[model samples]
Target: MSRDTGTDTAGMTFLESTPKKMLNAYLPLGAFLFVLLFPFYWMAITAFKPDNELLSRDGNPFWINSPTLAHVKKLLFDTAYPEWMWNTVVVSVTATFFSLAASVLAAYAIERLRFSGAKQVGLAIFLAYLVPPSILFIPLASVVFQLGLFDTRLALILTYPTFLIPFCTWLLMGYFRSIPFELEECALIDGATRWQILTKIVLPLAVPGLISAGIFAFTLSWNEFIYALTFVSSSEIKTLPVGVVTELVEGDVYHWGSLMAGALFGSLPVAFIYSFFVEYYVSGMTGSVKE
Candidate 1:
C-alpha cells in the first residue's frame, strides 16, 4: 500500500546502506589491493631487515623493528647494480626509439598508403609478436654470434626491435586507423607530400599512441630476461632483471636483503613512469579500440 503511494526508487539510489556498499564494492577492491601490494610490502620489510631478523624464526616477520641500510649499501657499492641500471636505461631507450621510428613508418604505410594486401600484412606482423622469445632466442643467439655482437648491449638493442616493431606497428596502425582519412586526402589535394603529412599532421596528433608504444617497448626491454641473459655475458652489461637474479644468489645461499633491495629499486622507475603517463596511456588505448 505504501509502495503504491511512492514509486520504486531502486534505480534512483546510486548506493544503498554503508554496509551494502562496503560489502558490494569496497571489500572486494580492498582484498585485491592487499593481494597486489603484499609483495612490495614484504620486499620493503625484507630489504631493511638485518640478517639476524631475516634468518630468525622468532618475532614478527611481517614488520621490521630495526631497519638498517646494510642491504642498500651492499647493493649500491658491492654489486654491479649501478652498471646494470645504466645498461637497462641505455638499451631500453635506444630500442624504444628505434622501434617507434620503424613502427610509425610501417603503420603509416599499412594504414594510409592503401597498398595491396595491407590488411594481410598487418595481420602477419601482429602474428610475429605471438612468437615466443624462448623459441626465437636460439636462432637469434646464432645470429648474434655470427654478427660478432655476442656479450654486448648492442645485441639486445638491435634484437629488441625485432619484437618491438611488430607490436608497436600493430598498435600504431589501430590509432592511425581511428584518424580521419579526410585529413590525408585534403593534404594530398593541397600538394602535401606523404612525409609532410605524417611529420606535420599525423605525428603531432598521434603523440599519445607514440607514448603508449614507447612506454610498452621500454618496459618490455627493462624486464626481458631470456634475451638479456642469452646475449650479454658481462655483469656490467646485464639488465636489472637478469643481474638481480644471477648475481644475488650463490649455490644454496641467497642474499635476501640485497636481492629485495635490487628488485625494489628496479621497479620504482617503471612505477613512476606509468603513474605519470597513465592518462596518455588510457587515451591511446581508447583511441586504438575505437578503430
Candidate 2:
C-alpha cells in the first residue's frame, strides 16, 4: 500500500500540482500580458496626465495623480488633428479599396484561371512585396513631383497601392487556392460564365479573406509615414502618424501629453477593427476552406 501510494504521488506531482501549473501557465501568461499591455497603459496614462506630473520625477509615473482633458482638447480644437485624421481615413479607405479590387482579380486569375506562367507571375508579385519601401519611395517621390501631386492626398492614395497590392495579392492567392476548384468546375458545367462563377461562387466564400486583406491594407495605409511625409507637405493633407509627430514637437521641446493623446486616439480605431473581425482574420490567415 505504501509503495502504490508513492508511485501515484510521483506520477501526479509535476504536471498536476498547483504550484507547477502556476509556474508553467499562469506566470508566463501574466508576464506576456504585462509586456504586451504595458506600453498602451503607459500611453493612456501619459495622455491624461497633467504637465506637471508628466514632467516631474517625484511621483509614481505609473499612476495618474490628476487626469485632465486639456491635451485632448488642444489636440482636437487647437490643431489640425481633425483634418489629419480625416485625410488618413480617406486615403486609407480609398487605397485599400483599390488594392483589394485589383488583388482579387490578380489572385483569382493566378490561382483559378490555369493560365501559363501563373506560378511565376505569383512569385513575381510576392517578390515585389519584399522590396523595401524606403528604396522605392525615392523614385515614387520624383514621379509624384513630376505629376505635380506633391502635397496632395491623391499622391498617397495612389502610391500606397504600390506596396499594398503585392501583399494583398499574395495573401488572397493563398486563400483562393485553399478553396476547392470543383466548385468552379460544377458552376462551369452548369453553363455559368467565368465572371458569374467568380462573382457568385468564389466571392461569397472568400469574404473572410477579403476582410483580412482589407484590414491589412487599411492598417498599412493608415500608419504609413515615409510616403505620406514625402508626398504631402501641407498640414491638412498629412496623415495621423506624420502629423502628430511633426506638429506636436518643436525643436527639442516635446509635447508629451498631446503626443500621447494623438497616438492613443489614432491607435484605438485599428484596435477596435482587429477585435471586431479577429475571427475572420484568423480564419483568413489560416487559408482553410470547408469543402
Candidate 3:
C-alpha cells in the first residue's frame, strides 16, 4: 500500500517535470522566432495602414486605425512598377540560369579532370569575386558603352554573370568534390558518356548545391542597386531597387506608402523561394564541407 503510494507520487513528479523540460527546449526557439519575424510583421502591418495612420504618432504601434489598399493600388498602377518588376525578373532569371550552367561545367571540370593550369584558373576566378563591384562597374561601364549595350537590360544580364559565375563555380567545385568518384566510375562502366552521367547522375545529386548557388545568384542580381543605377539610366530598363527609389521620391516629397509597398512586394518572391527551398538551402550551405 505504501509502495503503491510511492509509485503514484513518482509518476506525477515525472509528468510535471516533462512539461518543464519541454518548455526549456521550446523557449529559445520561441524567442528566436519572435525576433526574426517581428520586423516583417511590422512592415506588413505598416503596409496595410492608411497613410494618415502611418504618419500619426499617437496611434497604436502594432495595430493600425484604418487599413486600406490605396498604397498597394498606387504602387501597382501609378508608377513604372510593372516595368521595373519585369526587368528585375528577366535579369535575375537569366543571370541565375547562365551562372548555374557555367558554374556546373567549370566545377565538374575542376573536380573530375586533370588539365594543366585548371587549379590556377579556378583560383583566379575565385579571386575575381573579391574585387568590389564598385571598382569593376567603372571599367565595365566603359566597356558596355563601347559594346553599345549601355542603358539596356542586356548590359545588366551580361555584367552580372561575370561576378556570379566565379563564386558559383567555386562553391559547386567544393560540392562536386564531396560527391564520391566511384559513382561516376560505375556510370562510365555502364556505357554512360560524360554528358549522360553529368545530366543523369551528377546534376540530380547536386540539386541542393545548385539550388543554393542559383538562389544566391538570383538574389544578388535582383537586389543589386549600384549596377542597375549606373548602367540603366532609362526608366524603362530600371529594376525594382533603382526604380522604386528614383520614382517614389520627388525631391523633398517622399511617397512613404508606395515605397513601403514596393519594398514589401519586391521582397515577397525571394521570401517565397527561400521558404519553399529551405531544406535545400540548408543542405547546400553545409554539404560542401570537404573532409
Candidate No. with top TM-score:
1
The residue-by-residue lDDT of candidate 3 on 147-223, one tens digit each, is: 99999999999899888887788888877877899999999999999999889988898876888888777878888
Off by over 4 Å in 3: 1-36, 285-291
Ranking by TM-score: 1, 2, 3
Any idea what lDDT model 1 has? 0.88
lDDT by residue (tens digit), candidate 1, 1-291:
113346776584565888888898799999999999999999988999999999999999998889999999999999999999999999999999999999999999999897999989988987887788999999999999999999999999999998889878988987788789899889999999999999998999888788888887778788888999989888988999999999888788888999999999999998889898876556544543443
In order, candidate lDDTs are: 0.88, 0.87, 0.82
Sort the candidates on lDDT, descending order.
1, 2, 3
TM-score to true structure, per model: 0.91, 0.90, 0.84
Q: What is the Å distance of residue 252 in model 2 from its true position?
A: 2.5
Which lDDT value does model 3 have at 30? 91
Backbone clashes in model 1, listed as residue pairs: none
Instruction: Give the runs in model 2 whose Cα sits over 4 Å from its true position.
Output: 1-14, 283-291
Sliding window of 10 residues with minimal summed lDDT for model 3? 1-10
